[model samples]
Target: MIRKIGVLSISLLCLAAITSCEKDFSEVGTNVVNNDKFETGEILLDVEITPKNIESVQADNINASISDYWLGVYNNPNAEKIEASIISQLGYISNLNNKDTDTTVFNLDKVILKIPYQATSTGTTDGVTRFKLDSILGNPDVATSIQVLENETYLNTLNPSDPSKRNTFFSDDEYLGDNVLSEGGIYQLKPKATDTTFIFDRVDRSSSLTGTTTYKDTIRAINSQKLKVPFLAIPLDITKMKTLFWDKFHSGEFLSKEAFDDYFRGIKIVATGSDGLLIPLNLASSPAPSVDFHYTISEVDGTTVKDTLQKKYSFPLAGVRNSHYKMTPATNSAPANNFVVQGTAGKMAKVKILGLDLSKSELTQQFKGDFNDNLNDYDIDDNGFLSLDELQKLFNYRKNILKSNSYLLMNDASLTFYINQAINNDSNIIPQQLFLYQNKENETGGISPTQLTDAYVDPTSFGGTLKKTDDNPEKYTFRITDYISKLLSGEENTTTDPLILKVYNPTDSPVNNNVLTTSVKSYNWNPRSVTLFNGNESANGTKRAVLKISYSKEK
Candidate 1:
């Protein structure tokens, strides 16, 4: 009886397998499988941000070598009314010749101070080329009053208190007193035609074949072309030039460069107007900014002219070029809970990360608050309580986690700032990028802004470029993985300094020796403004600024 029962069971099993193969397979158990068992998730946290009005920035040592000096007055509706000026010292004339030892009489024809405009040729029309000034901020049609004043203050290259460091000058320095040398009158951003046409010498090369004899003929011709290059031609006072420079031609003051610098300090170019534009003047360009002394020298022997010659002595504007800025804060024009960001001694925003310094108990409470419903799912010990030690073991993973037994890792940490579209709708005036830095206390108990360590590690990944949707700038995103990781891992100070958000200045150094650094000297020449939503929950709601961090943790 037992053998018969075993054979019957084997036959039934074979029949069942054969019947199932004949029919179509069914997905009845597919829904029972857990697809999200090992999936990772992210946590979004809100960050606090506030507006900070900048009074001034270090503007000394901002010469032609590092960056172009700005000059003019501009009224920004969002931030401040800025008036930019330049104070520059003239370089000395090397190798002075004693030609005036004889009876040589010097007669000043005219003294002119020329500052070439940064212009580009648009097109040639009717034998004349049209040009437009480059890097002109605000309305170019408005006229401004320009004045060149004698700077009585001596500009030192090194700090008087500490010779090791370079001298620092703020934007609000009063370098020009009542010493007006040349009042340049009302001036607009228009190209000025030359008073006289320039004569150009051209050579034409032509080849002619006649009776198997080749003849190459070269003809030299003179062509007249009226050249027009945009520049500021301020007619300086000839009498003043004679007294300041010409009279001391062969005197002891001209014997040394330092002596001449002490005698004639420098010139300050100031701009004043109700409505005007700001322009960047390139003092290092060809035919740089200079005071040209055009004169004629006649060798007079008892009123009998022996020899006569026309000459020009150009005193180039060089050495210790500083920018002075006077800013009047704008009225409260931005929307409620909106902050402003501007360049060139403007304003910035201060940022603080929430819950960045929580204790173990506080962190456990926050974790519970963030994942109250899923706390039981993550509690692997099968206990009703979830401890901080277990959560750390589960989520605290190093950047290189292959060597450790950690079960979770942070992938990215970023801050997204939404633009206030009502105030910052104009794309032309919006800043192309933004920068995030931290202010470190200096030796003198002063704070200085410096770049984050992530920027130095990889600038491409540490993004601050403007993000747009449908070709319209909508927001700016910054990747701060290293910085956030350090804070989480207790590598950095728990009481972290507030990060500063400002308009990106291209001249600021992004990296040095594989470490991030920033320029303490003033180099932000851009005059643009942008308004962003401050992280005020009562005002902005969901659109308020927040720190979004994506991570991968065990389920």
Candidate 2:
């Protein structure tokens, strides 16, 4: 009898060899796993303390040690949106008093649902917590009731399919069936009138770098064929664009598109991804040329300064290089087309431009030369050509600077989505919205971004300390690479999550190297993560450019 009792002990029960009738998975059937196999994940909303209610846990110890409950993400179509808003609002939720009641908190235009999911060491998890999705106004407010559970079910099946295995990015779109497929998913987007358009909220890669156009009436043949333009966001309005600065001609409202023909014309407003890739912005019809504006760089310095040689990886190369060139950050308010100097004598330059047609003669002449003080005053005439007086000034600049035709056309310029995969990586590689977002004030909730000045480790943040359970990371590694590269190439007819990272080299000036970067970094992930939002990762290797990814499902 004593031996039989010992066999049934809670600790020894699983190993007891008594019943042949028991299922092989009985061990896992009894507990929620803390690994990457499940799609559903969970987060502990109240990290303060265990309630006087749950007796088994060190409620007081756990609660007392937590500054605020750190959140994990899963099953969210918009983590970037949520993360930014959380950072700004400092989403601090607490049931300090453990009230059963609720109240409205903050209202915002960009608050998405607060799903219950997060990745942990053992597996993705959730605390038996629930909160209302949102208020009638779309923004969430109020502290609501929560049910913190030590155990919850995680049932998410992840299909680590290959991109090369499929015919196109869309074969699995409608077939994905509740899996929450994203850009890096097996499925591609299909064209539809309802497809959302994106606006270039910001493009750090966008430059005032333009070569003179050699316009010919022959080139004026309009592209009558309708195009599907996608933007990073949605319908662009003058209100949102007004925030960016473009060089003013000291002119009027100029609302009438008809009056803007002479020097700048035949340009259309199309949607682009946050990185400035042309996305399907207007589905109803293709975009048409409207108006042209001046272009300018912000910083005036002639060169990029290196902060510290050894710290290249410690700080983003984008910041270092851009800071080196004393150029300004170009904005929607800047002139639509303009030429800016990149390098001084004996030095190379990094100049960028957008919105000018290199096919136009007026531009070609201006760009064909080394544009400088002498290049200025190139008079513009109707029908688009230099006033001839300006041609003389350009004659000198073009001679010295433009030796190798000194001009290259960015005809291939268009919006594209980009992706980089790692054996281990974080979802923060997804482009987050910096313009509009907010946090929830309540403790009990759905998806709310959790802020951290010293944020917890993510796939990108993870050093070599974590284990290598990179099963899922390996699966998505290849797909994510193709997924992002395709987006950067502007491939259409595929479904993508709203989240994307707007990347660019911080150099407002020109770079000696072609790799452009941005401060924003994030990624799209495997659907199985029910609770993990983004991974705690940090890129590694002797070359800072070498990317590395890692994760911690638990302590």
Candidate 3:
């Protein structure tokens, strides 16, 4: 009886182990098997990469999509000369009480264009405060003439041809040949002693008891605080502005927003000379860039002055702020050492897989070269040619690779791009990240760039961030396991379209929990560049771009 009980216990233990190892292979369209019957390995594939220079990009400033507008010229020794200028439409101030009987006169004071610098205070000293400007790309001390001009072109909101679509503007669009508005002079990043002080009120509130159960009105104390802020106070031509803007206010041109826009189209701020002072301007900041119309209204009692009050009407530099880039192509047509990648209508690279579109027969022939031993399970007849039954089995096997079935499973697939340190050694100027998108052809025969399927599935996993190490090469690696699996399984058709690699923009991903339906419509304002190996090097070159894939297959 004791021997029989021990035998029964052993039988039940073996049955439990077998049941736990059973797998529902129907999920992956494969045969049922145990989990420990597969072998894991990795392979490296070749890819073709080519560099393409971008002449211009769609840089429309509609709805203030682009936050940062560049101003100044950047001259790089290895790359092109980039000239950036700002053309913006001014916002109108409505509801001005011109009919007030208390104010009978309007006298124009000095008009100044205030453009605030992106700076942070470096602590106070005695009674004065000092600040350092942020992201001054080139030499900040270099002098350059900044010209403010009246924009002659009327920036339309809607497209005239289609009406349903918004008007699109390019970085290379022309907005010159207008009357100069600024008091032309050489400008530098010199913080003035007089304009450094700013005054603001600091209010304190407290409660006082009036009765046993009720409290009196809150007691308040107001104190004025003075601090220093850095900004560019470019004086405009007072005479021209009075005739053009101030006089028009009384002439009923400022009655409506449309009337004002038609009369005064916009203003253009352009930097002259190749002094290499690229100022990053954020017009959307608080106390935005504007043309201040400082004036005074005098209250008179029958031609006798009663009281005088200083007033100001500010026309903000808002609505349709466009950045026009004038880029001069690099002199060297070919950089034999490395390929260049830049932002803001700059250079990019086109990437393509070498054998992504091979037919079943071709793929079988290629598989015979390296994975011939693994094909033994499918080719049951031991024939060189794959029959219909064998082809169906091969398709199922590849499909199961993505599902991690017992038959086969794809673990990872990635592409690593090594940086050319010989050229792009400056970490400050090197782009922090790179973006890759598919250049798909639309029905209108135009190429539209879109994010890859891998990005949509999981952007975190589809990495393109710059990876650095103490001993290894600085590189950008992208994992595209799903993309490769679809291609290998014939689930997705391989097209002639190639992947475009460009500088990363925040708009490349969805914002504010919005659905990512389209590619980036705004211009890439990041003015940085990097040089990378094209992967067409010799057979033994380690820096050559290649797709590395790791997978598990039936042994």
Candidate 4:
């Protein structure tokens, strides 16, 4: 009886060990799901794919009223002149009170145009930032002439049909003082360090230097104020413009701001040199851009005593001006079909997906190609729709597999974008970051500018890292798991508005807080971004943009 009991206990122990081993294997098998398969089961891993094409559009009058003060832009190295101009609107003129005294000689005093530079440079003893408009690939001390000409063009207030005429003033507008302000009379705007002790290269490449040979030290600040000095002090030849000013002022036109605007218009500064400088001024400050008129007034005091007294007048710059840019497309960008996006907010390259369709037949065909799995279990009809009954089969299969043995869930989902580097090899010109937003149109049927909250996904957090395979750089994949989930769960409000990928600049602001609601487009304060061709297109590349998904099943 004792031998029989011990044998029975041993048999029970063996059976229990076998059962435990089977359970462990079953759990392991449940955790393992085919990466490239849409197997029949209670939990199915499926993906919705959409291919898109890109379109390019130029925003109307984008450069009309910009924030930056454009010094000059040398589009073609071999070209004769730079395609940039600076115009200033005259504010209240204080010295215009004595318009009656015509005989009073208004001597040609020094006319200085004060422009404060933006803090594009940093790293000094005081740790303040400054910037200088210097050459990148030319002589630093090379003498450059800035011709101060009076703007005779009229700024129309009426709305026009043509976009080019929207600004009212054209680049080729009649600039007064062409002959009056001779080249010899114009002073050379030579760049110099405010601090004599600090030493650095005045002219150098931008921060986007790709190679080691080009980078240079940034300009240093002095006394916590390196850029405190006003940028350009080009003394205008008051002798030549004296007659124009005299005629306008004595005619009682300077009495009213509107009359002065029509009579004097504004001043235009044209830069002439081989090298160009990107000098943007802080127009939103004191000592603002202005013209000082110095004159002598003769007064007979009491008893025929003629006294010559020196009096001064000031004309502040009215806050209306813009920096114009003329860009010549490269050989690659010359193609008609090629999409292009550039500048801050000047232009935009668009990525548009056709309709979002995940029909039963469409799903089956797309899945068959993507999964590459022999779905022998699914009795799918070749011509008919993949009906609910067929889909239930897959679910039922998954359920049976997970019956008291395994578990599964989705792991990740993403959308990938591949950049065509070959399109633009110039590393310095490439955009630092890209933005995605819902491109909505306003009441005017124009693509409205995006606000800060409109950004859907950014590369810093959701964008893919640069991946290179062999010698070729691959695509940038962004995790759109939540976005895709919303679409699949029928929770996304994406029917009316589609997604658009644009070059994003975080520091973008309105030209003026007061005129923000006006028709004028905001300045492109952000960094430039690149134009990405559709990956699905054969002409650009074979790498197609895809919504990738991965999940597991319990069975």
Best by lDDT: 3
TM-score of each: 0.74, 0.15, 0.76, 0.54
- lDDT against the true structure, each candidate: 0.64, 0.19, 0.65, 0.43
lDDT tens digits by residue: candidate 2, 1-555: 000111111111111121212323222321233344322221110001010110011111111121111111111222111110011001111111211112211111111111111111222226321222110110122211111111111111222264333111110111111221112222121222222232222212112112232222111101233222221111222222222111122233222223222212111111111211011111111232111111223221223321211100000001000000011222222111111111100011111111111224535443443343442355555534442224333333343342321121101111111122321154332212111011223347443322211112121221111121342221111012222222222334211222211111112111126543222211111111111112211221111111111111111
Q: Between candidates 1 and 3, name the one with more favorable lDDT.
A: 3
Highest TM-score against the true fold, candidate:
3
Assess candidate 1 and give its lDDT: 0.64
Looking at candidate 1, the ten consecutive residues that score lowest on lDDT are: 1-10
lDDT by residue (tens digit), candidate 4, 99-197: 434343333333445554443453445654434443222234455556777777554444356645344433333445444343256656555534222
Task: Give lDDT tens digits, candidate 1, residues 225-272.
Answer: 334566666667667777887887888888899998988889988887
Report lDDT (Cα) of residue 55, candidate 2: 9
Decreasing TM-score order of the candidates: 3, 1, 4, 2
| Candidate 4: C-alpha lDDT | 0.43
Question: Tens digits of per-residue lDDT for model 3 on 69-177?
Answer: 8888777656666778889899989876534364265566567778776666677779667677666665646665678899988888888799898887788899755
Off by over 4 Å in 3: 1-39, 95-106, 121-130, 185-228, 297-308, 331-334, 356-406, 470-473, 493-496, 510-512, 518-522
Residue pairs in clash, model 4: 41-397, 41-398, 42-398, 42-399, 345-524, 401-555, 402-555
